[model samples]
Target: MFTTRPEIAGTFGCVSSTHWIASQVGMAVLERGGNAFDAAAAAGFTLQVAEPHLNGPLGDCPIIVHDAATGAQRVICGQGVAPAALTVEHVRGSLGLELIPGTGLLPAMVPGAFDAWATLLRDGGTWTLGEVLEFAIGYAARGIHYVPRICATVQTMRPLFEAEWPTSAALWLRDGGPQPNRLWANPALADTYRRVVREAEAAGSDRVAQIDAARRAWYGGFVAEAIGRFVAENEVMDASGERHRGVLTAQDMANWRAPVEAPVFLDYGNTRILKCGTWSQGPAMLQTLALLRGFDLGALDPMGERFVHLVVEAMKLAFADREAFYGDPDHVAVPLQTLLSDGYTDARRALIGEEASLEFRPGSPDGIAPRTDYAAAVERARAAHEAAGSGEPTVSRLGASGGDTCHVDVVDRWGNMVSATPSGGWLQSSPAIPELGFCLGTRGQMFWLDETLPNGLRPGRRPRTTLSPAMALRDGVPWMAFGTPGGEQQDQWQPIMLLRMLHHGFNTQQAIDAPAFHTEHWVSSFWPRGARPGKVVLEGRYDLGVAKALQARGHLVEMGGDWTEGRLCAIRREADGQILAGANPRGMQGYAVGR
Candidate 1:
């Protein structure tokens, strides 16, 4: 029932949502004689329109590119930076609120996607933005979809969108922004799209004009400008970038720019990993793999007792470093060298005994920094998770953030490859710049509310992001390029999927469709201050015997219900030059097609 054109040679194969916008974008690039980077960029831009609630053209994207020819790898940091109007004290000042409420002006960054598109184009793109974006513009104007998931999710948040921004509320809510299943359209947004295209054509490579046009529509455009003007004509944004902190003027929108830089790399055995810097847990991926190598996983069989225990131990160690050290490299001193070093991996691996789980609790380590605050940090995380109550958590029970994002993979006929995890959150908090058809991401909540923490809120600094896209190679060729969109689950899922696919000889679909588990069971790895400990959680799908087995062996085994949250889309290039791509069944809206 779930099949597509099988492993064809010289065809552009892509996987994304059921919506034609993403699919059409990929197909368009193929038709235009462009490669996978071009196809992936087009799909990302189109998803912004088709899956606006989840992602946007103005959202942030982290990408991994594999050049099959030179066998070189590159990662692009498409994440945006915080506004100049933010500070550490402001976050610490707001004590009682839950670390900035997960949404609003505070977390919004200068959108980074356009710059990523431009960079991909600059590096090597045969198609123009106008060609790639046509399908998205048409869908925006004509309004062609309403799947069960989107419709249901939208119904729940209709009032929130309307109350925050009337134009979006109108476009989203239909008759005056209050109904659940109402069909809505924004001719205002259609006009904005038209204006952006005309402006892009006229400006000619002064691409800032196109960006300016989108920014104006989202902020000072016909839809949102009146709201901004009435709120505060001269109320400039203050040091706390939180929505309430800034007047969020059109000027603020005009000044933002996305940075494009080379990704940080680590060599693990024959595989080279390209990851975004400390802003996300890209480096930790390599660290986990390094530690896991110390054990003979192949000897234990894929899902057997010994293999599972070793992986769990490696994950615990990786999360230990993740919680204590990883943060925005530009802001904090992340111990990248030590964490990925063979010596560190060897020491951490030595702690794991072959027969039983370690008696030592998670985060039971000496302080890597000056103050000896390790014990205190652990206690806080333990208290918080325990307070939240454990056992069988889902999106609704977790007080779900509107963090739904999209992941897509493209493998071109030319042996080039691309993996991009593009993301944006709820649109209400930071009002959209009307004409832009996109809103700034309120990702600021990723930081600590405490001023003393390493990831304190700051201006011009990029928040420690969760969107990590990655590429894996074997024998200097593109073996797999994959990633997912499950906030805290991103890092945990990455290694598990690799083990299933690489070590176990599973097909792309088999590895992605299989049930999996993660150890970082909480709000974010950055939480739970000083020496608090937790248990290892397994999926309910795993046999009860395995849980009992781990528990008997000195491990805490919590059971997640039978449902899976991580959706991995991947493509494997066979030795015969055919491309095999697969998407997870969990994503009802997902699909993969090639021609």
Candidate 2:
């Protein structure tokens, strides 16, 4: 079969990521006999240096790891929570704002990526704290030949940096923000990493103790002090970004740590797919799978109009439920078991008709009423039609503020594997802290100000985030690790890749290189939230007849450039012990490397 690139084949190890440098760094760790956890941690830190516009140290990550030694699959919750002082009254009453701004300081949350990587290294790997971070520190101190996309983003944000955020301008606005031809270096970031290492080594040579010391340095010591001062001194913002003070503090950062928990999973045929809990949009994928099992997926052509229609219709239902019920289970009671029960899934599946659904139909699982602010939703949708866009998209520029996410997948020779999606704290997300050379993320924008819904903004509550990673088990053993870097589009692309592999006999690269599609029918997860009913965008490589067929069925179809959809990276270990990997070829940026 023809593909954009050959499926990488090996028995030793495999690593795939949104950026080539991160993948190479992960492979370097594996070559040195580090486990998958160590490799993933190394790669994760390198991503912050290599793709500063896409992710940073202060961002969030949700990781799924399959450990062969314990015969277990575990999830590390790298997602952060809102500040204890960021109450609904503070936003809606005192700030006199109905919605949080997409940019600026008000939407900042406790950063979780750094601690998450440290936790993984401590609990699962044999590498030292200083060893994994060395790669990222080297790139920052010397120089990196960055891609045009990063250069473009820095230039675009230069004005905002120069005008309102002088500290950011000091770093990013120099020489028009890293020229496309020259290598750019971040000396401040390098020094920051070096100082952390010094603090870790001060705790003695024991590996676990050193890792714990580094965590303290971030959350309680120098890093936290810098963030606390910066946020406390800054002003809060409305949608217009003009007034108020930031609520984040050192106390919030110190109070939080990345949590590890068992993942919820479903087994269909010989494959068992696992995802994070209802706190994320992950369960929506499981819901789609439960709904699709009744269909004769094998009989339908995976590339034809029929397959696209069935998948899209099923996704609409699943996402509708996501908006209605999914949230941080610690604060709210999410009916997950009822939502995934055989009776509820089959009943919901019966709603997919030949005609498209223009209505937002959220189901009533267990006879519970779906609580939502419909009146406010309609108003927000209308304002969205007028407001210029804002959110995380991979384009050179988008909306009021623009940024994207990053993904890494690694499989080691020891039968260990990891799939992680790390994102937020982009260059445009907020102004940088002068001392640390990074800023906080705007994931708090995902919370509803209504204070009544499951995803409402509450102090110390986790916002319903779009950052999701995925893993799969074949028969009773671990097999695939894969994910992508699109906000709502993360889960959409993976299921299609899996279906093709499961039924059409497509290899890893073939599945990743195929045409992709997704719906934009739900409420926006970013600022100026909007809803576009029955809208679908398909990669133009798919047949024109498929688009026309969908339009005839009352679906609004728009054609995108053949490569405009998603950037997915995947790696799998076969029962024969052969390792295979694949990366998206759309932008010619993502790389899959292995021996």
TM-scores of the models, in the order given: 0.82, 0.97
Best by lDDT: 2
Off by over 4 Å in 2: 236-239, 373-382, 385-399
What lDDT, from 0 to 1, does candidate 1 have?
0.61
Question: Under the 3 Å rule for N, CA and C atoms, how many clashes does model 2 have?
Answer: 3
- In candidate 2, how many Å is residue 346 off? 0.9
- lDDT of every model, 2 decimals: 0.61, 0.87
Minimum summed lDDT over a 10-residue window in model 1 is located at: 233-242
lDDT per residue as tens, model 1, 1-595? 1222232233445544334458567866777787787788778766776666677655788887876666677767777666565555555454324455454454556666666665665465556556656666676677656555666665555544544445445455665342333334445555665765665566466544554454445444542454345334322121122235432344554555445556776665666666777788776677778888877666666655566677777766676566566677777777777777777677778877755543332332334652224455555566655754864232222223355678888887777888888887344334454544455566666666554455556676667777888877776667777777776667777778777766667677666666777654323532222232336667667778877787777766788876564577777776677777766566465656665
Give the top-scoring candidate (TM-score): 2
